[model samples]
Target chain A: MIEQYLLHLFIIACVYAILAMSLNLAVGFTGLLNLGHVAFYAIGAYTSALLAVGLGVPFWGGMLAGGCMAALFGYLLSFPTVRLKGDYLVLGTLGFTIIVEAVLKNWASLTRGPLGIAGIPKPRLLGLSLSPLPAYALLALAAALLTYWLLSLVVASPFGRTLKAIRDDEVAAGALGKDTFRAKAKALALSAFLAGVAGALYAHYITFIDPSSFSITETILIFSMVLVGGTASLLGSVAGAALLVLLPEPLRFLPIPSDIVGGMRQAIYALLLVLVILKRPQGLLGEDTLRDAWARARRRRKGA
Target chain B: MDILPQLIMNGLIAGSVYALMAAGFSLMYGLQRFMNVAHGATYLVGAFAAYACARLAGMPLALSFAIAVLVATGLGVAINQLVYVPLQRQKEKDRALLLASFGVFLLVEAIILMVFGADVKSFGLPVRKGMDVLGAVVTPVQLVIILAAPLVFLGLWLFLYRTRTGTALRAAADNEAIARTMGVNVRAMTTLTTALGSALAGVAGILVALEQNLEHSMGLPAVLKGLTAAIIGGIGNVPAAILGGYLLGLAENLGIWYLPSGYKDAIAFVILILFLLVRPQGFFGTRRREEAGG
Candidate 1:
C-alpha cells in the first residue's frame, strides 16, 4: 500500500512538473505575468478527455489533438492582448480564464457541465495496457524526462535567449532590432502547447475531467510552484512540483477534520510562499546580482 | 419603462456599494502603488465578523458593524506592519510583494474557512419594505447606501483637496521621495492610508452583507470588481474610482437584463480590455508617469 501511494505521488508529481516547466517558459523566460494559465490546461484536459472517453480515440492521438487545440487558442488570444504590460496582461489573462470557466460550466452539450467526464481509458503501448501503478509511473517518468530535455533545448536555443531578452527589456530588444511582438507570440504559443500536453496527460492519468479540477486557484498553485522553485531552471520546476504535490498527503494521517486539514495545509503553503518572496524575490536559484542591478537601475531612475 | 426604473434603482444601489469598496482600494493603490489582494480577505472577514457579532453574540447592529470595521482596520494595519512594510523596507522585487500578498490572501481565507466553515451567514436585520420612487422600488438600505456613498466620496474629496493631511497623502502618492524630503513621514502615511482604506472596505463589506449573503468566497468577487473599477477609472484616480464603480455596477446589472447573466463577469473584462487597449491611463488620469518616464 505504501509503495502504491508513492507511485501515485510520483505520477502526480511528474504531471505537475510538466505543468510548472511549461509555465516557466511564459512566466519565467518571457515575464508575461499570466494569472489565468489554467485555461489552456482546461482546454487540453477537456479535449483529450472527450476524445478518449467519448470518441474512443487512443491516448497518444488525444494528447496531440489536445496540444494542437491549446496552441490554437493561445495564438488567437495573443493577437489582441499582446500589447498589454504587467498588470494589464494579468487582468486580461484572468479574464480569459473566467470566460473559459463559464464556457466549461454552461456548455453542457460538450462538457456535460459539473457532472464531468470520467472513466477515461489509459494509454496502451504495443497493445499492452499500461494502466497499472508501476506502468503509469514509468510512462510519466518518460514524459517528464522528454519534457525536461525539450525545454532545456528551447531555453538554450537562440530563440529562447531572445525570449529572455524580451523579458529583460522589451524596449531594449526592440532597439536592437528584435520584433518584440513576434517573440512574445511565439513564447506564448509554445508555453500553451506545453501546458496543453500536460493537461492531456493529466486527464488520461486521472481518468476524469471536471471544471472544478482546473480553477483559478489551481492556476495559483501552479504559479506558486514555479515561484517556489525559482524560475529560469528546468531542475527548479521539477523540484517544486515534487515537493508541493507530495508534501501534504502525510498530514492527512493527523486526527483533524478534513476541511481544517486542507485549510491548514494551504495555510502552510501560503506562509512558505510569503517567506520565499519576502526573503528572496528572485527565487531559490535566481542570481541575486542581476536582481540587484535591476533594483539599482530602478532606484537611479527614480532619483533622476 | 417600469423595469427600466427598477433596473436604474438597483444599479444605483449596487454601484454605491461598489463605489465605497473601490474608493478604499484605489486610495491604497494610489499611495503605495501595489495591489493589496489581501484586502479582499479583509472584506470577507469583516462581513463574517459582523455576522458573528450580530447573530452569535446578539449585539446591536450598529455595534456589530463598528466592531467589524475596527477588526478589519486593525488587521490591515497588522498586515502592513508584519508583511507589507517589511518587504517594502527590504525593497524586494515588485512581483515578490504581489506573491506575498497572494499568500497572505490564501492564509487569511483559509483561516476564515476554518473558523466560519463554508456556510453563508446573514445579520437578519429588520427588513424595511421598499418605497415606490417614481414607479421604482427602493429599499431603505438602498436609499441609505445611495445617500451615504456620495457623502463618503465628497468627504474623501474634501479631505484630499482641502486638508493638510490629504495634501500630504497626495504628495506622497505623487512623489514619495519629494514628500519624504519635505518632512512627511512617508511610512506613517502609508500605514494610515492602508488602515483607512481597509476600514472602508470593511464598511463596504457590511453594507454588501446587508444586501447579499455573506460567504467566505465573497472577497474574491469584491476584489475583482473593485480592481476592475480602479483600473477602468485609472489605477490611482479617486473620483474616477467611484465613477468606474458605478459604471461597472450599472453595466453588470443592465447586462444581465440585456445579455445572459453568465456573461456578467465577462462584461467587466471586456470593458477592462477596452480600457487597456484604448485608454490605459483611465478616464481622468493624467499621463504624468507614462509621458514623463516611458
Candidate 2:
C-alpha cells in the first residue's frame, strides 16, 4: 500500500514538473506572465480524454493530439495577446482561463459538466496493460525527464539565447533584427504544447477529467512549484515539483479533518511561496547574473 | 418596466461591492505595480472573521462587522509589511511576487477552511424581508448597500482627490522614483496604499457576506469581478474604478438574467476580452504609452 502511494506521489510530481517547466519556458525564458496556462492544460486533457474515451484512440495518439491542439490554441491566442506587455498580457491570459472554464462547464454534452469523465483506459505498452500505479509513474517520470532535457537544450541553444534576449529587452531584440512577436509566439506555443501533454498524462492517470480539476487553484499550484524551484531553470522545476507534491502527503497523516488537511497543505505551499519571494525572489537555483542583468537593463532604460 | 427597475436596483447593490473591491485593487496596482492575486483571500478573511466574531463571541451583527473590518485592516497591513514590502525591497521578479501573493491567498483561504470547514457559514441572523419601492422589491441590506456604495465612492473620491495624503499617494503611484527624488516617502506610500486597498477588500467582503452566504471560495469570484471592474474602468483611476464596478455589476446581473446562468462568470471575461481587444486603455485610462515589447 505504501509503495503504491509512493508511486502515485511520484507520478503526480512528474506531472507537476512538466507543468512547471512549461510555465518557466514562457515566464522565465520569455518573460511573459501567462496566468491562464491551465487553459492549455485543460484543452489537452479534454482533447486527449475525449479522443481516447469517445473515439477509442490509443493513449499515445490521444496525447499527441492533445499537445497539437494546445499548441494550435496557444498560437492563436498569442496573435492578439503577444502584442501586449506586462499586466495587459497577464489580464489576457487570465481572461483566457475564465473563458475556457466557462466553456468546459457549459458544454456539458461533451465534457459531462461537473459530473466529469471517468474510467479512462490505461496506456498499453507491448500489448500489455500494467497496473495504473507503475504505468502512470513510469510514464510521468519519462515525460518529466524528457521535458527537462528538451527545455535544457532549448535554453542553452542560440535560439534560447535569443529568447533570453527578448525576455530581457524586446526592444533590444527587435533592434537586433529578431522578430519579437514570432519569438514570443513560438515560446508560448512550445510552453502550451508541453502543458497539454502533461494534462493528457494527468487525465489518463487520474482516470477523470473535470472543469474543477483545471481551475485557477491548479494554476496557483503549478505557479508555486515553478516559483519554489526557481523559474527559468530546469533543475528548479524538478525540485519544486518534488517538494510541493510530496510535502502534503505526510501532512495528511495527521489527525485532522480532510478539509483542514487540505487547508494546511495549501497554507504550507503559500507560506513557502511568500518566504521564497521575500528572501530569494529569483528562485533557489536561479543565478544572480540573470537578476543583475535585468537590473542593469532597467537602469539603462531609465537613464536613456 | 418593473423587472427592469428591480434589475437595476440589484445591479446597484452588487456594484457597491465591486466598487469597494476595485478601489483597493486599483490603488495597489497604481502604487506597487503588482497584481495582488491574494486580494480575494483578504476578502474571505474579512468575511470569516466577521462570521466568527458574530458566532463565537455572541456579538451583535453590526459590532461583529466592525470587528471584522478592523481585523481585515490589520491583515492588510500585515500583508503589506510581511509580503509586499519584503518583495519590493528585494527587487525580485514580479512573477515571484505574483506567485507569492497567490500562495498567501491560498494559505489564508486554507486557514479559513480549516477554521470554518467547507460548509457555507452564515451570520445566523434572519434574512430581512424585501421592501417594494414603486415596482421593484429590494431587501434592506441591499438597499443599504445601494445607498452606501455611492457614499463610499464619494467619500473615497473626496479623500483621494481632495486630501494631501491622497496627493502624495497619486504622486508616488505615478512615478515612485521621481516621488522619492522629490522627497516623498515611497515606502510609506506603498504600505499605506496596500493597507487601504486591503481594507477596502475586507469591507467589500463583509458587505458581500451580509448579502450572500460566506464561503472560503467567495474571495475568488469577488477578486475576479473586482479585477474585471478595475480593468474596465482603468487600472489607476479612482473614479473610473467606481464607475467600472457599477457597470460590471449591471452587466453581470443583466447577463445572468438574460443569458444562461452558467454564462454568468463568463460575462466578465467576455467584457474583459472585448475591452482588451478594442480599447486596452480602458474607460478612464489616458493615452497608451509605448510598451516595453517584452
Candidate 3:
C-alpha cells in the first residue's frame, strides 16, 4: 500500500514539475509576474476534458489540443500587458484569473457549474491504457521528462538568452533589434502549452475537473515552487515541485487534528514564501549571489 | 414602489467604505511607490480583533473599535519597518516590494484562518429601525457610513494642506532624495504615513463588519474593489479617488439590477481592464505615467 501511495506521489510530482518548469520560463527567466498562470491550466484541463468526453478523443490528441488552446490564450493575454509593468501588470493578470473563474462557474451549460466534470477516461498512449497506479507513474515520468528536455533546449538557445536580456533590460534588448514583445509573447505561449499538458494529465488521472481546482491557490503554490527551487533554473523547477509535493506528506503520518491540517499546510507555505523573498531573492539555486549589490549597499550606507 | 432610492442608498454606503480604503491605499502607494497589498490584511486584523473583543470578551463596541484600530496601526507600521523598508533600499526593488507585500498578505490571511475558523462571523449589533427617505428605507449605520466618506476627505484635505507636518509628508512623497536633503526625515514621514493610512483601514474594516457579514476571504476582494476605485480616480488623487469610489459603487449596484449577482466581481475586472487599456491615467489626472521596470 505504501508503494502505491509513493507511486501516486511521484505522479503528482511529475505534473507539478511540468507546471513549475513552464512557469519558470515566464516568471523566472522573463520576469512576467503572471498571476493568471492558473488560467492556462484551467483552459487546458477544460479543453482536454471537453475533447475527451464530447468527442472520445484519445489522451494524446486531447492533451495536445489542450496545450494549444492554453498557448493561444497565453499569447493573446501577453499583448495587452506588453507595455504594463509592476503593479499594473499584477492587477491585469489577477483580473484575467477572476474572469476565467467567473466564466467557468457561470457557464453551467458547458462546465456543469460547481458540480464539476466527472467520468473522464484515464490516460491512454499508443493504444496502451495507463490507468493502473504503477503504469501511471511511468507515464507521468515520461511526460515530465519530455517536457523537461524540450524546455531545457528552449532555455539554452539564443531565444533564452534574449529572454534574460529582456528581463534584465528591455530597452537595451529592443535597441539590439530584438523584438521584445514578440519574444516574450512566444515565451509565455510555450509556458502555457506545457502547463496545459500538465493540466490534461492531471484531469485524466483524477477523472474529474472543476473551477475551484484552478483557483488563485494554484497560482500561489506554483509561484512558491519556482521561488523556493530557484528562479531561472530548470532543475530548480523540478526540485521545487518535488519538494512542495512532498512537504505536507508527513501531516498524514502525524497526530494533528484533521480540521487544522489544511490551515497548517497553508501557513507553512506562506511562511516559506515570506522567508524566501526576504532572505534569498535569487532563490536556492539561482545565479548571481548579490555580492556586488551588497557591497554597493554598504558603501551607500557609509555615505561614500 | 420605485427601487432607485434604495439602490442609490446602497451605492452610497458601499462607496463611502471603499473611499476610506482607497484614501489609505493611495497614501501608502505615494509614500512607498508600490502597491502595499499587505494593507488589506489590516482590515482583517481590525475586524477580527473588534469582533473578538466586542462579542467574545463582552467589551463595549466603542472601546473594542479603539483597540482594533491600535492593533491594525501597529501591524501596518511593523510591516513597513520589517518587510517593505528593506526592499525599498535595494535596486530593482519595485517588483520585490510588491511580491513581499503579497507574501505578507497571504501569511496574515493564513494565520487569520487558523485562528478564526473558516466561518462567517458578525458582531451581532442590535437591529435599528429603518427610516424612509425618498421612498427608500435607510438605517442609522448606513447614514453614518454614507457621511463618513466626505468627512474623511475633508479631514485629509485639511491635514494635508493646512498643517506643516502634512506638507512635509507631501514633500517626502513627492521626491525622497530632495526631502532628505532638506532634512525632512523621510523615514519618519513614511512611518507616519503607514500609521495614518492603517488607522483609516481599521475604521473602514469596522464599517464593513457592521453592514455586511464578516468572512475570512472578504478582505482581499473588498480591497481589490477599493484599488479599482483608486485607479478610476487616478492613483494618487484624493478627491478624484473618492469620486471614483462613488461611481464604481453606483455602477456595481445598478449593474446588478440587470445582470446576475455572480457577475459583480466580473464587472469590476472588466472596468479595470478597460481603464488600464484605454485610460491608464484614469479619469481625472494630469500626469501621464508608465513604467517597464527599467
By TM-score, the best candidate is 3
Supply candidate 1's per-residue lDDT for A260. Answer: 78
Question: How much does each candidate deviate at the interface, measured as C-alpha RMSD after superposition?
Answer: 3.0, 2.2, 2.3
Writing each residue's lDDT as its tens digit, candidate 3 over B158-222 gives 99889999999989987889998998998899999999889888888888888777887777886
Model 2 stretches astray by more than 4 angstroms: A287-304, B175-184, B288-294
lDDT per residue as tens, model 3, A1-304 = 9999999999999999999989999998898888888899999999999888889998889999999999999999987775677788888888888889888898888888788899989986677888999999898999899998998899789999999999998889999999999999999899999999999999999999999999876788898888888888888889889988898788878886654566677777777877887888777766555565788899999996
Model 1 TM-score (B-chain only): 0.94
Instruction: Give the per-residue lDDT digits (tens) of candidate 2, residues B1-294.
Output: 558887777778888899888888899888877678788887888888887888888888889888887888788788777876666656545655676777788888888888889888776667878899757898887787788777767777787889989888899988888988988898888878877888788888888877788888888888888988988998777778878999998998888887878988899988987887777767888745753222
TM-score for the A-chain in each candidate structure? 0.93, 0.93, 0.93
DockQ of each: 0.43, 0.59, 0.52
Backbone clashes (count) for model 1: 0
**CA-based DockQ, model 3:** 0.52
Two-chain DockQ for model 1: 0.43
Give per-residue CA lDDT, model 2, range A162-229, as digits (tens): 99999888889999999988988999999999999998999988889889999988887888787788
> How does candidate 1 score on lDDT?
0.82
Q: Which residue pairs overlap in candidate 1's backbone?
A: none
Quote the positional error of residue A273 for candidate 2 in Å: 0.8
